[model samples]
Target: MPTLKTLQPGDEPLLEAFLWQHADTSMFLRSNCRAAGLLDEGARFQGTYVAAYINEAIVAVAAHFWNGMVIVQAPVHLAEVVQAAVTQSGRAIAGISGPAAQVEATKSVLGLSNRPTQLDESEILFSLTLADLQIPPALGAKQVQCRFPHSDELELLCEWCAAYNIEALGQKETSSLQPACRQIIEARQATSVHWVLVAENTLVSYSAFNAALPDIVQIGGVWTPPALRGKGYAKCVVAGSLLEARSHGVKRAILFTSDDKQAAQAVYRGIGFVPTGEKYGLVLFEG
Candidate 1:
C-alpha cells in the first residue's frame, strides 16, 4: 500500500511532472500547484497538497483547496490515499472534483455518499488541439467580434456570471454572486482572459480560460443569454478565445459539459473538440 504523505515545498516539480502525463485530467491540480505551491497561505488558489510516492516517484496527487474543493487525479484504488491526505490536512472539504470514478471512490471512502450536496455531477471531458480549430462563419465574416470583456462592461458580465452560476453550478442566489463576479471581472490573469462575443454592439456570449498554463488551457464559464443562444455564439466565443491562447503558444484546450446538453456538445464539436473518453467530477456542497 502506498502511504499518503503531505508534500512540502520543493516537491512541486515532481508532482507537476507526474500530473503532466495526465494533463487532460490534472489541469486543475497542475494549475493550482503553480499558483499556490505546496503550502496553504490562506490565499486564493492556495491549498494543502499531498502525494503518494514509490521509490522517489510521485504516483498520485491530491489537494484540499482553500475554497473547500478537494481535487484529485489518482487511480480509483488510490482514493483512500486521497481521503487520508484530506483528513490529515484538517481542511474543510465542501466539494470533491476529479476523474469520475476516482471521485466516486473517494466520496465513498470519505463517507460523503449520503451527505446532501448542492452539486454532484460527472461531466464529459472534451479536448481540442488548436491546430485543428475551425473558425465559424460568424467570426470569419466579422458578424460577431470575440474579445475580452471591457472594464466598463462589469455589470453586464456580473449579471451573466450570476446567471451562469445559477445554471451551471446550481447556485440558487443571484444576489450573492456579485462579490465573486466582481473578483472575476477585476482579475488580471497574466495567462488567462474571459472572452465575450459582440454583434451589433451587443454582448451575446461569454467564456473563459479558467485554468491555463503555457501549453494548455481549460475552458469554463461558457454562457450565452437564453434569448441569445442557439445562434452559434457559444462556439464563436470559445473558438475565438482558443485562437488568442494559441497566439500566445497554447497548444490545446479542454472543457467539461454535461451529457444531456446536446446543443452545447455539438457547439464544441463544431469547433473541433472531441470527447477525450474521460469524465470530470464537479461535486459541490452547500455552505
Candidate 2:
C-alpha cells in the first residue's frame, strides 16, 4: 500500500532525488522552489505537496496548489495516486502540467472532459533535439545582434516584458508584474539567463532560458516591442537564444506556447522546433 504525506522544507533533498531519477536531461528548475512557491505567503498561495510511499521507499510525489487552479505534477506511473489526491481535494477544476501522455492519462482518469479555458488550446511544448542549430552564415548580413543583458538592461527588459504581458494577456498594463520581474532578475540563479536583442542600438526584444533540469533548458519570456512586430525580430531573438542554450551543453531546449497563436507557432516551427504534444494547465476555482 502507498501512503501519502504533506511535504516540508526538509523533504527538499528527497524531492530532488526523486525528480532527478525520472526527469529528462533537459529540465532544470529545482523541485524545491516549486514546492516552496506553493506555500509562500507573499505570493498568497496555498497548496499541498504529497509524497507517495510504498513502505519505507518513496515511489512518487505530487505538488498541488489552490489559487483558482489546482495544478498537479507527478510521475506518470503515479497517476492513480494523483487521482486519489485530487478526489481528496474536492475541487471542481484542476490543472496538470507535464509530459503529454501523462497529462492525457490523468485527464482520462478524472473524467475531466471540460476543456481548458485559459490555456485551452494544447500548450504545445517544442524542443530542439539537435545541437547544430546554427545561424546560417549568409544571414549575417541581416544585421541581427545578440548579447547577454548588461546590468543596465533590467529596466528596458522590464518595460519590454510589461508590454509583452499586456499584448499576450490582452489587458492594460498593471504594476503587479514590476516587482515579480525584479525578483527574477535579482535572484540571478545559475540556471537562469536573461538576454536582450538589439537592432541598430534600439532594444526590440528579450528572451529568457531557464534550466528546468540538469540537461533540459526551457525558453520563456520571448517578447518583442509592439512597434517592431512583423519585422522577424522575434524569430531572430529566439534562434539566437536557442543556439546559445545548445552551446551551453543543453541536450534539449523546450518551450510552451498556446496553440491558438498560429503565427508564433509558425515561427518556432520555422526554426526547427517540432511539437512533442499538448501541455495542460487545469484551473480549479475557489468555492
Candidate 3:
C-alpha cells in the first residue's frame, strides 16, 4: 500500500508538480490551490491536501477543502487510500466530487455516516477541444454579448450570483457570497475572467473560466436567470465563454452538469461539447 502524506506549507511546489501530471483532470484541485496561495483570507480554509506515494514517487492526489468539498483523481482502487486520509483529518466533509466511477468507489470506503445527505449524482463531464468548439456566428457576435464586467458592475454581478446559488446549487443567499463574488470579479489573472452575458443592458446569463492551466480551462458557475432560461441564451453565453478561452490560447475547456439536466446538456452539445464521462458522489454534510 502507498503511504498517505498531508501536504505542509512548503510542499506546494512539489504537490503542484504532481497535479500537473494530469492537468486536464486536476484543474479543480490546481485551481483551489492557486486561489489559496493568492488570497490572504484563504488561510481560513486550512483544508488538507494529501498525496499517496510509493518509494518517493507521488501516485495519487486528493484535495479536501475547508468547505468539505473533496475532489480526488486517482485509480479507482486507490479510493481506500483517499478515504483514510480524509477520515484521519477529522474534518467534516460537506461533499465529495470527482470522476464518476472514482467518486462512487471512494464512497464505499468513506463509510455510511459520511455519505451525502443531498447528492448530485451521475454528473456528466464534457469537454471542448479547439476543433470541437462551435460558436453560432450571430449568437456569439450579437445576441449574447459576453464580456468581463467592469468593477462598477460588481453589485449586480453579486446579486446574480447569489440568485444563481439558490437556483442552481440549491443554497440560500448569505453575506459571504457577495464578497466572494466581488473577489472573483476583481481577480486579475492573465487567463481567467468572469464572463457575463448582457442583453438590452440587463445581465441575462454568465459563465466563468475559474481555473486555467497551460492548455485547459475549467468552466463553472454557469447560470441563466430562471425567467430567462429555455430561450437559448445559455447556449450562446457558453459558446462565447469558450471563444474567449480560445482567444487566451487555451486549447480545450471542461465543464460538468447533472445528468438530470437534459436541457442543459443539450445546450452544451449545441455548442459542440462532447460528453466524456459521468462523476458520481454525495455532497455529504457532517451532522
Instruction: Compose the digit string of candidate 3's lDDT tens values, residues 1-287.
Output: 78777766777777787777766567777777776642213253345667787777677877667666777877633665577557656666667766666676666667644444534565777888966788776575695587777667777767777777666666646677678666555563233467777788888888877576657888777888788988778877778877877877879888877878888889889888887764534354433
The candidate, 1 or 2, that scores higher on lDDT is: 1
Error of 3 at 175 (Å): 6.4
* Best candidate according to lDDT: 1
After superposing candidate 2, which stretches have Cα over 4 Å from the reference?
A: 8-48, 55-59, 64-71, 75-121, 132-142, 169-172, 188-192, 282-287
Runs off by more than 4 Å, candidate 1: 188-192
lDDT per residue, candidate 1, 100-183, as tens digits? 988887788788888888788899999999999999998989988998777788788888888888888888784567888777
Clashing pairs in 3: 100-279, 100-280, 116-284
Whole-model lDDT per candidate: 0.85, 0.59, 0.70
Give the candidates in order of TM-score, highest first: 1, 3, 2
Better of 2 and 3 by lDDT: 3
lDDT of 2 by residue, 1-287 (tens): 66776666676666667666655321422433452443423242344556677655556755444532333446534565666556655545545555455556666666764654333334777767746454633225658776677778777776666666556644344566677556665544323576666788877777786444445667777887767877777777877776676677767767778867888887777777887754634232112
List the candidates ranked by lDDT, beginning with the highest: 1, 3, 2
